[model samples]
Target chain A: MWRKVLTFGVLVVFAASFLLAAPVTIHFWHAMNGPLGAMVQKLVSEFNQTHTNIVVKADYAGSYSETLSKTIAAVKGGNPPDLVQIYDIGTQMMIDSGVIVPIQKFIDQDKTFDVNTLIPQVRGYYTVGGKLYSMPFNSSNPVIYYNKTLFEKAGLNPNDPPTTWEGFKEVAKKLTVKNADGKTVQYGFTSGLVGWFFEQYMAVQNALMFNNENGRAGRATKSAFDSPAGLRVFNFWNDMVQSGVMINGGPGWDNANGIFASQKAAMLLDSTSDVGMMLRQAKEGHFELGVMALPHPAGVPYGGVIIGGASIWMINTHNTMKEKAAWEFLKWLEQTEQQVQWSEGTGYFPINKNSLTKMMYQGFYAKHPQYLTTVFQLLMSNVTPATRGGLTGVFPKVRATIEQALSKTFDHAMTPAQALKWAQDQADSAIAEYNSLY
Target chain B: MPRKYVPYVLLIPTFVIIGLFIYYPAVMTFQKALYKISPFGNRSFFVGLRNFENLFNSPSYSQEAFTTLIFVVASIAIGLTISLLFSLLLNEKVPGVGIFRTIVFSPYAVSPAIAGTLWSFLLNPVVGYVSYTLLRIFGIHSEWLTSYPLALIAVMVATIWQNLGFNIIFFLSGLQGIPNSYYEAAKIDGAGAVTRFFKITLPLLSPITFYLAIMDVVFTMFTSFGIIDIMTQGGPGNTTTTLIYRLYRDGFIYFNSGMASAESIVLILVMAVITFIYFKFVQRTVHYR
Candidate 1:
């Protein structure tokens, strides 16, 4: 009887040990902050709750640029997180880093996951040589956010926003309000000195910013933005600034948004990711907001705005268990439900094509028509190489060069042609230097 | 250990720290300046000073260097002058002098970035209180940050304001350390305030002034990154892009670590020359007593 009792106790102890085994932990570094960060935490906790065998640790790693730098430093220090979120412009650089395991590898191995389900424009930006390196998380494009009340006050139709650059200028001129003292009290349009907008304008004109089909066909050897298409965009922008229809909103997104929110500017060109915040700001400002697609230059076939924002990249740790666990979390994040949740929580539209078909999103779109405007813009965009966005390791530097060109043009220190030429030269040299090293 | 070795043994920790943190990084940066390094530092090849050559050939580098010189000289000259004036005034035996002293020194307690943020808000074109007041009263739309010379001036003004407290603290202490007997003797000699200031006070405070000048030069060169970044982001067509700001752009934003390292080496050399000149020529004017 004593021997039987000992065997029973040993069996119970063995069962307890097996039941209490440690779960695999996945480290995730992201750039999301504020309400979006809270949503990320909520999703992580929910995932942790349902998946008893896996625990995901999420960390807010500052801004997109900071996160990329921190991730690279961590990788060099031999303690990188399993996954990291990097901005759209960092795609080529991250790909060239040779540190990330392409998400396509897991997609190919996982028979249940469908790669084609992602929105083409969103997926195309992250795809290199027909393979997606990262999972599209937050995708956005430039959109015109106008104050409808201001439009009406300016004797313009609130529903019919301009679709062409010339028409945009004409409307902007009309919207500009001046006092009896010859002081302009309200400017018509304002945008930050952001190079992303320049790139979008180029895209809308079906213009390649760099050679080799915007670097998608191959590595871009030189900047192609000094062409007529580039000059047209620059000339239009310069004319607006020169004519005093638009105000220089300075160098950051917040400044332009402030100009609009304070009723100092009638329209603002900004990322669609700001839709939720813009809506709230409009409500606070007691003005009705209207959203529209970015205007294209006249007599040009509209290409479309390139996909902006960031994607989640899986770091190569050479540990299959950690890799698989991270991939599982990524796949879970791409689910229609989670996509809908993310879209509603943040202004970034869902990249999963199936999410649009869901009844939940249908109802959500019906209630908030402004959100559908960005979705329609994305759907209408042509999936050409120009719209696929430029792929170069020196994209950030190229963008800075473009911004400098814009600044020179705006300051009237250089004409549009001269500024673009300067930018082209600087960008080409930067690209050459980066290509040589990479 | 021998008796001589005892001191060396005690100094080991300091040597180790300095070697690890300062000398090691300096050596690494010098080595990196000769190579073309990938952004992640995974791959590199010796380029042998090509980065420095490229920088020298670039127009932007010269422009930035010029801007850096103007910023350093202007900030130091104007900053020191205003700080000396405020310190002298606060040095008077007036009522509420302690409060004035605290107010003058308060900005020194604030970080450069915080000072920059505060100043940016005050100087913002559309909604800034200063701009709004100017528009309302004078009808002048001063685009403080987006315009050319104004952008540089705005950055300088903010930097000077932020650094004023530091200079004031030093000048105030230096003033306090001045023996009252010297001023009494000057008064007896029938020396006017200005004459006394130029002759006695200025020369006697030369040591502190010289020290402050060197510190201010270094501060304006290296520590003005925050103010420039916040106010203008070295913008309006590179009108305000200083060498330090350029270095940050290359190293952090653009990920041109090799070029950044090269720029850093150049910066170190520039500072060394400046300090050398200060000690060689300016030190002779400094009076200890």
Candidate 2:
């Protein structure tokens, strides 16, 4: 009698456990770190708790560069994860790889999901030829962050920052301070010399960076950065450097951020995502911080800040059930509450339109006015062909080429036109290589 | 299995590992050089010698070749000279010989990437203490990483510093094997230290010097990837990009496998010819006891 009862209990326990075991687990690789990574973990855990039928495992890949490189290796190795977060610059390459499923297909098969709810400018970056390729996640724009205390010390208005390039130069000249030995103790302005600034400044002037309407109508065959507007931007920057008001800060973002945080520079041009970081650094250093949109020429009417950040893409090289589970997780991620939580936690502008209406978000933004500047900048953007962003399969490489050009002109005494002409040639060749392959 | 085949059987594991990790990829690299491959390794097409032709005809080829030549030759020369100096001093009858040997050989334990990062931080104009002192004392603002020539020089310094310890050890061991009777005889014959070093010690150390020279050249040519990657990344206008770095950039960063493979083939041919020349020239001059 004892033996029979024990066998029955064991069989029942095994059967119940087998029946309750979760279905396929979705592996997601992303590049979020620090507070943003923690927020992503929280969201994934919440989804796991709500959906008892499936489990989602989130892994933090290093940076966008590392993540994309690893994802390419994973795809070629035939062991791809269910989802990956790729930067917007990688959209063309992602599509060319043919490793991802169009999120539109999932939206088409599902009746509840709506693609129209996405913010237009944010959505436009990930779309190609009338098809949405990836889900927009973190999006930001370049903004001018200034030391409020320094502005007051320089006798400029603390509340009003320059919105035009010429006016900005004038204010920057006033803000620049030098020691008795004629060595500059504080530069008037410093900007990150990465390729994104060129892209953003071009968008602010309403100029296209690549041919074929910024490559939305068709594939880009060449880069258009050596045009008249580009020449103007380069010449303006060259004059700033020559005048001893602006520091090049080299080509890395960390160097520029260091220059700004250490109070060696009165003003800095950087990403909107860094608003929270900049404020935190200022608080630690006891400096007042202010924010404004990036400056272009006088006539463009704040033409616009272009979107900059990574987006999430679903790789469908797995089984059908896994893809379904991944799609469900993505849908849950796109919820209004989740979007607000992400934006508030990470200072990335909200990708969802309805998320702006939430009382919690409003309260948070009221407390942090610096973050609101990004929202207004995005709202006021004109969404021109230039602002939609340059789409080429070799954008990452092209950006490297352009940054090299910036270095040559900024540090090596090369003329702006000469550096830009060399960049144009290199970019054209790179684009040709990419186009031939695809 | 025959009894005579047992030794062959014992060697099978090593052979398999070498074949799998070394020979197989080498063969595949040669094969892949003839084709244009997609990102996913699907839809490959043969393009013959076009990849090679394009690489040679490209405008950046001359700069890359010159940079590689300068980096390899300069690093090998610097490594051998410094290591030889240190080894000679350490091989003396000085006190704390063991500690001095350890001190001289300690840097070899550091990985190339760490060394590169350390030197980069130390050489940074804004934050580096070395640069700060130089500016304060002498008013010399050396752009260690910004200017193309200075950046290549920085990379070479880092590479030579990291490789010096290994060469020192080889030269030290070579010094230990030499009989002391000849040195005493030279001293008795009224030969000065410099004359004794050149006539007696150098000839005795020829075999070791030959070995180290060939190895230093090969290591600088092929194994300086990590230093180049961290310090300069072949930049300021491709001034620090060596041939190996170029191969990796084209293959991985640009996703052009055919050209990378063609570059790899060229690298192999260059290395093979270098080794042939090195052996033909240096082996004849080496004197064994």
Candidate 3:
């Protein structure tokens, strides 16, 4: 018994020593929870299976905000993860924080890396002062999701969905059902109301949401949401709520999606990224659904919606070899085949234009033509600096103000003018405050 | 045991841990606060007191500081009061006490992220069960998280609900530890329930109360990060942006490490000072055996 125990103890020590000598582990922190979280783990497993020298450990770090906080804390503590997926709005902040080495330089160093073929809009957001800082991992935008059954139930043609705001309003009013006491039984339209959605909405309307090339040019520009077109959009949204044509979908995107999925609301404006999950839920509920471009205001420019999604930055928290490994991973991620697989699996628009030509994407589109809108939105986007996206040093703060403004407008707590004025004032102050730091 | 060196041996592990985890970071944060670092890991020349000066001059910091204070104070005060009241009621021979206890303590066991996610879903303006019930019952419809003035209140409500259970458990333990002889003595002296509670119960639970208050204050300030981060994100016009969240944003979001480090040092100092003040001023008011 003593000899057997000694043998086991010796084996355990040998295993421990082997593990200690294993290749350097690169930690990746992310906020992809639920199904996507599992999918990410699978991706890491596949990566580990292929790569023998590098072991990538995936840590689930709650929501996007939580993940950001954790990454920052780690960076501050001088023990940051080798890789982290940061949301687009935080790109500027992350770029300014010198810890991240631009992956473009590394890609440039690698003769095989063909980053030039990257989807322009995807790469555009991460490029700071004409240099790319991060790689676009997930690119999504708000799209109009409608319940075909609800459209039919309201005696409207299921195939014909609204494309313009006026048309949307008329259809929404018609589709809204009232109970015996005149209370709403089924709402016509709802959306995840926040600045990001409004920003996309404004982009669709060809309105200048902010100045300084919408933060792509430089950080000195102030927000231009107080423009005439901006006021009109806010007023239009307010009117929809006041007329009971729309309901407060929820404070954010997920809530809005829930209301529509539950059939409590007929139409939803949510991220195209949620398409896969929504489709699964719809299949389970046995509800037929339709997808359409987000409704644009009448007579607006044909400038398409802004790209909204997350990207991965190569943080300089590692040594040269680790940096090279990260670049290799990023390059692999951007490859047409990989992009096609990722986009098809996640319902996010591929960040590589070449990926769209892949048979996998074509096959998916052939099965569900609805999948084409994700690519169409990208192609139709106005290539001008302003229409590309909104930028500001304090976009996170500005987003909060817009949410507050919209909340009050929707809740009947204040008028559109009042809310806009407050938001404008708040945003102006935030911009000024953020500018002072430099 | 080796009696001569026993104390030193025992003290070594604790001192090493405290040094590595707490003291070392505190000292490094103070050092980094003086130097401005760029996004490329480029170190800037030391700008003595400039980050603090910038913090004071900025309206965002002012707003964040005030919000943090309000959030910490309100959450702790309201959470403790509700728990205390519930504990008093729970002390009685109530039906299904164990079930009630479990229900109250359930939120405590939940991770803060889960708690935030669940409560955010519950408090959503539309399709949220809580919101639907509240509106139907009271004819009140408000965006709990998005409304500017009330956003803080909404955050506090979610925070208190998730925390009240844990506080109740603490208070319950404290209440049970109070000997029955004291209550029996109070009854003999013709003390009514209110007097007994105010004079005897409250006073006797003072030590636990002190500890809970300190722990709650520190925990609420430093840790609520998850709840606020997930729920409000210091949003709806920075109404819920606490000091920690702002520190996070400035440091991580913008990569303003110098500012973040400066803010961290300030945060630590504020926490230490407040704790010292509480122990000195408030701790004195409490009675303990």
Docking class of 1: medium
Models sorted by DockQ, best on top: 1, 2, 3
Worst 10 residues of 1 chain B by lDDT: B280-289
> lDDT tens digits, residues A125-173, model 3?
6777888888888888878888898899889998988889999999999
Listed per model, the TM-scores of chain A against the true chain A are: 0.95, 0.94, 0.91
Model 3 residue A356 CA deviation (Å) reads 2.2
**Which pairs of residues collide in candidate 2?**
none
Among these predictions, the greatest lDDT belongs to: 1
Model 2 Cα lDDT, one tens digit per residue, A1-438:
999999999999999898768467899999999988999999999999999888999999887877887888798778888899998888888888878898878888998888888888888778788788888888999898999999999999989888799999999999989876676767899875678998888889889889999888899998888998888888888789779898766545765677788787899989999888999999998999999888889865555778999888999775788889888999888889898888878888888778866724469778888988888888788877788899987887788787778777766557989999998999998888768776
Real contacts recovered, all predictions: 0.63, 0.26, 0.26
Off by over 4 Å in 2: A1-22, A33-39, A359-362, A411-413, B89-107, B178-182, B277-288
Docking class of 2: acceptable
How do all models score by TM-score?
A: 0.95, 0.90, 0.82
